[model samples]
Target: MPTSQAIQVDNLSKRYGKDVQALAQVSFEVGRGELFGLIGPDGAGKTTLIRILATLLLADEGQATVNGWEVRKNYRKIRSHIGYMPGRFSLYQDLSVEENLRFFATIFGSTIEENYELIRDIYVQLEPFRERKAGKLSGGMKQKLALCCALIHKPVVLLLDEPTTGVDPVSRQEFWEMLQRLKEKDIAILVSTPYMDEASLCDRVALIQKGRLLSIDQPGKIVSAFDKPLLAIRTNDMYRLIHDLRAFEPGHSAFPFGEYVHLSLRQPIWPEAIHAYLAGKEHTGIEIKPAQATIEDAFMELMTREVM
Candidate 1:
């Protein structure tokens, strides 16, 4: 049985101007304390969706609720209870780190001292530079400060929109670790990210595109659902390899992945034939191996299926 919902939406839709539909009848429910991720690429309406849920933007159609407070009716109450960290760093660049934290705490009629422990772990990283202007801080420092400000009031839900975008790899890892600690405290977290690797960090993820929900499942379950045997093929000449593989009939799908090409032979029986053909082409260090499909692969397959 499903647990109580921390957030719920029904047939949500949004549009800008006349032709651009930002969202299209999207609906999903997130359970209490669950780290739910909304995964998609740019222009996938992730920001718009988060804005709506945060009570910062009105939806064109449908309704939603956070912590049992109706979004449309009790937006004021909802806003007070939800912490939102936008994709862009929107903190006061001229303000010192400590000043920024104090301001956000004051907005919620709370004090940093009252809820200090809630943000203490994250704020300690920023404490050394507490007197420094936000603009002068590095990407990672800014990220930590932003998070501290957002959590200063101990909101029931944390909504982070692509919070790991430009930070260093070490910082990204640290940020995720902090999230793990937050989740342990039973705070519901909804994070949106364009990166696929981050999807596995969440308890469950909703693969979204064009403002529509594609699939919602545990990371491992979603990956297990991937049907085709994926192949990671590498060669000395990747450019020529891609051209040749695409030229093969049955219209195989291939995309550049790191140093290799992720190729899915359109037809099952053609793997051997394709391998032999590639070897005949005098490709050096030719390696073809069955590979696991990642969240990105599942997302691509879902998008392709949607398009078809």
Candidate 2:
């Protein structure tokens, strides 16, 4: 057929009881050979959407398909062609690394020898611990082992839910590099994470918050679409900077970012104006500079509008 199958969702919705809406008519499509990221904070329905795609959870409304097979109609077929790695390390703790891989391969009616190349790169890193108990492995090793198990079946689509949530920085970087290599294999990869910085690594990202999608586009496009003047304000007293900036622009947006207070200006004003205003408040070491908008910044801007 095509290079690989696509994951499609249309007006997907999920709710818990009558109170919490886990997903609100979410819709998106992930093309083959593309790495699509669902970027959101905890409780933003990222996991729920990922679970639905993996056929582990059912949605209350709307339709979803993996590899053109509807989630409800042909779930077994879909499962056979897709690989899922949940946020947690779900491998058999008692099983050795090699045993775990073999177990998963046998369950899928395959063998490591049959699809060795698919996972060679990742598995090579874990080979030294082939006989080691999965639970005894380090976090990074555990992550690699789990990934090997997921890819042993040679799946056409890979679903990763918060794959790097608790991983160390270097391990996280390594894991992402593996994903990039896998993407080159024409596998449609859909990964969800709460880390905004990781959004830039994806081919496209969907910004979700509170079970609703805020924006969907390339990371660069999302940042560029924010056509507002962003400024970082720092002073000798960082705590008072936020209050002073808010007082200066009541209708504008001002929030703490790193060592400075980031302010989103609704109208253009020279940097000198802010210097004069903050100086009037008797603040020292005043530093005001234009800041670039990131995916996180764009998400915050959209969420702020949604609340107001």
Candidate 3:
């Protein structure tokens, strides 16, 4: 482990029974004070990796260090130096919001007031509901309390596993803003999210699927690496457009994207050729134009490549 890295994982692999490989030789590093995102969909092993680093679970074969301490050899030390917020809200439902914070702080041999400066921004918002039961709080308020508890000890590293999975969009945005502020204090943060749009917010992201690492780099770099030109196509018949485009001779891939279908070509061809092909198929209102490659596009491309 380097001094600059807050967390380091090497060839970490974990399996459930004999068939389900939750993480397959997954390796990456989170630099100090950097916000690193583990981007993936459901059951993609994002949580597994986070748990390993958090010292909550062990890897079947591989090594991981948090805050310069080996996970297995120094579980206590790692746990003390890092904050972990699991995907699900894991707090005492009966305890008041302030009580939950106090409990976590006491567990770490500290008091909320001792580290009030570190969590002031979040705690202030939670002050109004300090006496409210944790279980009775709204989704956003619960999220805030969980984060405050995680930061009660003022850990150097933070591991958040899909913290915004079921949160409202506004809360999600606010949470990320809080994370940005946390980074200003030089606290390394490793966050996982299923949303591709959130990937861009991280300094760097590792795209994972089915327990395997697909790609790791800055969001912009990954998008820039998409070699093929992309086009957004839409027609009167949205459902048939996708199948028809995939059936086209020059089409390499066609997938529905919201109101339009994103099509990739095996080789560059004139737009007129695409227009003519669709027109021949009795497709009308055919609109095709160049589109920029996005993080979602890059993830889909990597998934397609992995399958092929």
Q: How do all models score by TM-score? A: 0.95, 0.96, 0.97
Full ranking by lDDT: 3, 2, 1
* Tens-digit lDDT track of model 1 for 16-112: 9998888999988888888999999998999999999999999999988888888888999989999999999999999999999999999999999
Candidate 1 lDDT at 86 equals 95
Error of 3 at 122 (Å): 1.7
Report the lDDT tens digits of candidate 2 across residue range 14-52.
999999999999998999889999999999999899899
Candidate 2, 195: how far from true, in Å? 0.2
Model 1: colliding residue pairs: none
**Model 3, backbone clash pairs (residues 3+ apart or across chains), number:** 0
- How far is 226's C-alpha from truth in model 1 (Å)? 1.2
Best-matching candidate per lDDT: 3
Clashes of each: 0, 0, 0
User: What lDDT score belongs to each candidate, Candidate 1 first?
Assistant: 0.88, 0.91, 0.93
Off by over 4 Å in 1: 1-3, 270-272
Model 1 local distance difference test score: 0.88
Model 3 lDDT per residue over 54-163, tens place: 88898999988888889999998888888999999999999999999999999999999999999999989999888999999989889889999999999999999999
The true-structure Cα RMSD of candidate 3 reads 1.2
